[model samples]
Target: MINDSELILNADGSIYHLNLKPEDIADTIIFVGDPDRVPEVSKYFDDIEIRKGKREFITHTGHVNGKRLTVISTGIGTDNIDIVLNELDALLNFDFETRNLKSEIKSLDIIRIGTSGSIQGNIAMGTILASEYAIGFDTLMQYYQKPYNSKELEIQEAVIEKFHDLTFKPYVAHASERLLKKFAHDIPKGVTMTAPGFYGPQGRNLRSQNTYPHLIKQANTFKVNGYQITNLEMETAGIYALSNMLGHHAISINAILASRVNETFASNPKEIVDKAIRMVLDRL
Candidate 1:
């Protein structure tokens, strides 16, 4: 059993999972899934203070245009988010040695800058997508005691009714408006669908059949009170859920890499990602 003390630190006094301390992280954090992308995103930082890595996780703390920020690679999926987000919150809000909580908990502003596919035809390749809301098809939220929004619950029920054949429970949540307003002008706003996997879960084939035949079509045409589904990714829902429960702000900005309907990929995918990262950094 991991107690508060055991969960607090490593023998070297760094954060347990991230290998970072409170001093090592900035108030503003940017998350990417690929470890190699850590340096790619941190390249724009004017002054870098720390660079650390453990397993697949890589982190860089730096300053950009006088604003301090930290970029971390979360590996992949909601399971990774479960580790990264909780540890990050602990780093900011809890005292490591004493294992005592702070009187005034500090909240961090987190933004996920990653790649995703567009389910809508109007949302083409090489464009930037900002998630106004995220629909989680993962099980992480089953452990939380946070109150569910009635409107969101209604939407979830409708979605489930429309596709009752699927095995998982549907979960939906919104992003932090405060963070969205900060980088609003940098990307197109839409609802992001969080899938469990990139292949069959997202309606892709592998020389075999899928459980949901029209899942992609259902997702593309899915609308809640007239809100159209925009992009599809794997991590944003978990980020929003855990961040909201912990009192931190979270949002996702995705570079449109693939189009499900058109079956197209960005011609210059690297260039698209580079532009999106630069734009986000400049805005921040």
Candidate 2:
């Protein structure tokens, strides 16, 4: 049985942060970073069924061609992802009435559609990157055991060798090949680095100084077994790692909005995001 400390629910018995009951969500979930983007993605749904919002987390479930889908907003950053992923798993994997773990676990298909900065010069602005693997520069998964696999170890070792003095212990996790082939098989695949912050962690220095000024340059040049660090975002790693531990299939489709190599940003990034949404929905 899950303790009350770990399993806090609302008066109506919905999940705390997400404020959603199991019936409100679908097996296939698409996560966005912005709350308002919830409607943008659900607009294409054939029929609207459920819509709920609490804090930065918003959920909308609908159907297309008799197929049900759920689009949810996770706000931003891996911190929010930590809450989102765990709560989501709880909803499916636990017997809420008894507060006991379910004997038969349920697996969900989770896909993150968000914007990212291109670390590779040739990746181009306004392009979409399908994250075959997510490299977590953040330490969100450090508390958990068995976080790194063979592929992840090789990727991190390569980065360490390239930047001998680098301090971050990065972990890599691959996207679900089942979901990858379903949604992003034809697209260009690359590895994504998930930073802890928008600035210093991603090697972006404004008025504040960054300890590792060359972190971005070194990471972009990192490659192992033909996988290159293609872009940077803030949530994919946590999503991939947590999804693996929880037995869910996860993938991230990134819209390239910034060019870290040439220092260029997208002027009308919303258009790019829309394109990505349509692309993912088509596959879904």
Candidate 3:
């Protein structure tokens, strides 16, 4: 059995999975999927103090515009978000030495900067799309037992009923409005659709049998009230869900590098990503 004592670290010791101690992180965090992007993001930090990595997870803690922040790579998908978000919460809210809770909880502000495909035709290449809400098509939420908004649940139920032929259950959640406001002008805002995979899960071409053949069309045309599905990504739903549950403010900004319907990729993907990152830094 894994004991709490064993799971917990010494006050000055680092976390088991992230290899990071409390002092290694700041209250503001930027999450990316590429390990290399950790350095790419941290390069803009005014004064970087710590850098660490394990497997696909790389971290750098520093100051940007006088604000202390940590840039971490969560690899890809909600499963990785499960690990990173939980560990980050523990690092901030738990007493590492005693394996007990702290009197006051520290809520971190998280922003995910990643690449995604545009679902809407008008959302062009090199554009940055911020997620106002994320529709999760993953199973991570089955583990949680909590109350959700009634209107959101109704929308999710309708979506599931509409796509009953598909294999997975639909999950939906919204990003933090506070974070959205903070980064609003930094990137174009839209509703981001989160899927399970880049291929079959997202209605892409495959050699074998596939699921949700009309998913792209359904997602693209589907709108909740007037909000349209603007982009497709893998991690935003999980980030929104976990961040909401943990009382952290979180948002995702996707650089539109691909258009699934048109089979086109941004000619200058790096330039687009760099521009998005620079805008985010300036806003921070």
Candidate 4:
């Protein structure tokens, strides 16, 4: 039995951070990093059954094409993913009435509907990318044990070698194959590198200097076993890594908003984002 002090639930039986109960979410969930984006995704549902919000965590559960589904906001970053995934696991695996573990557990299908920048020049703006691998440049996954096998060593080595200018060690984790087969067929497959922040961590320059001046360009050209680095984002690697360990299936669908290779931004990003969101919703 987990103690109430450590595994706290609200008096109303909702999870503390998400203000959600076991029934509030469906096993198939679509996660967006922005709070406002939650409704945008849920608006396509046939009928919304539940709506809950707390801090940056907003959840809307409903039916789409006779299938029950959920759209939730995770704010941003893997740090928030740590909170969201654990609380979600606890919500399903713990008995709210008894505050004890359940004998049977359930796995979730967590799909991220978010935005990213294309590191490769050929990937046009507004293209939807299916992450074959989400590599983390952040230190979040390093806090855990090793997440790769011998096969991914070459991919990991390539990331480390290309981003050598940075101080932290990088790790690579692949997306859920089950989810990929179902959703990403006929789409452009690429590796997504998740940065810890929006600026310097992604090689942006301002007052402070960047350790890797042409980091994005470097990642764009990186190739190992003929698989090239495709894009950059902030949440995919965290989502993939945590979900892999937590028994949840996860995948990220990215809207290309910028092109680092050509120094271009999407002329109408929300249009692209909306297209990407609808694309995932249609498949989900």
How far residue 236's Cα lies from its native spot in candidate 4, in Å, is 0.3
User: How many Å off is the CA of 79 in candidate 1?
Assistant: 0.8
- Highest TM-score: give the candidate number: 2
The residue pairs that clash in candidate 2, if any, are none
Error of 4 at 8 (Å): 2.0
Quote the lDDT for 40 in model 1. 95
* lDDT (10s digit) by residue, model 4, range 1-284: 77888798888989889899998889898999999999898889999999889999989999999999989999989899988988988887889888888999889999998999988889999899999988898898778864576646788887787778778888788889999988899799998989989998787887978877787778877888879889999999888888878778999999999998888998999999999888888887
Clashing residue pairs in candidate 4 are none
Tens digits of lDDT, candidate 3, 135-253: 88888887875356875686687778767776667777887888888897556788788877878888887695775678888887776667777989899999988888888999898
User: Any runs in candidate 4 off by more than 4 Å, and if so which?
Assistant: none
Clashing residue pairs, backbone N/CA/C < 3 A, model 3: none
Model 2 lDDT at residue 231: 94
Q: Is candidate 1 or candidate 4 better by lDDT?
A: 4
Model 4, CA-based lDDT: 0.87
Clashes of each: 0, 0, 0, 0
lDDT per model vs. reference: 0.86, 0.90, 0.84, 0.87
Error of 4 at 24 (Å): 0.6
